[model samples]
Target: MLHVNARGMKCPWPALRAARAMREADAILIEADDPIAPSELEALAQQQGWDFAALDACRFSLRRAA
Candidate 1:
């Protein structure tokens, strides 16, 4: 598991960092206060067929599909 802090990051930055971490992780949990985090990550997960769950308004978790 990997945790990414994107509280102050802008769009693309959080997504980009998360993507980088995804390369090395089987699963990742991303925490971002940004409003765009969920949408952006949702699209990415959908495109990749990754499993994702929104923990709350500002936190989400992604798991690699088996």
Candidate 2:
């Protein structure tokens, strides 16, 4: 699993980082403290057909569609 630490970053930044990682990784764990990160990341996963899970309020895991 790839790990992306986007803490202290805002909305699109966190999601963008995750998306970039998805291109090369099968699974990614992103940590973003922004209040909107969860929803934004979830939307990205939904659109891309990846599995989305909230490991916690500030952490998310995304897996590539199989």
Report, for every candidate in turn, its global Cα lDDT versus the true structure.
0.85, 0.96
Per-model TM values vs. the true structure:
0.91, 0.96
How many angstroms is residue 58 displaced in model 1 relative to the true structure, after the best TM-score fit?
1.3
Clash list (residue pairs), candidate 1: none
Task: Report the lDDT tens digits of candidate 2 across residue range 1-66.
Answer: 999999999889999999999999999999999999999999999999999999999989999878
Regions of candidate 2 where Cα sits further than 4 Å from its true position? none
What does candidate 1's lDDT look like per residue over 1-66, in tens digits? Answer: 899888898887777877888899988889887788899988888888889889998788888889
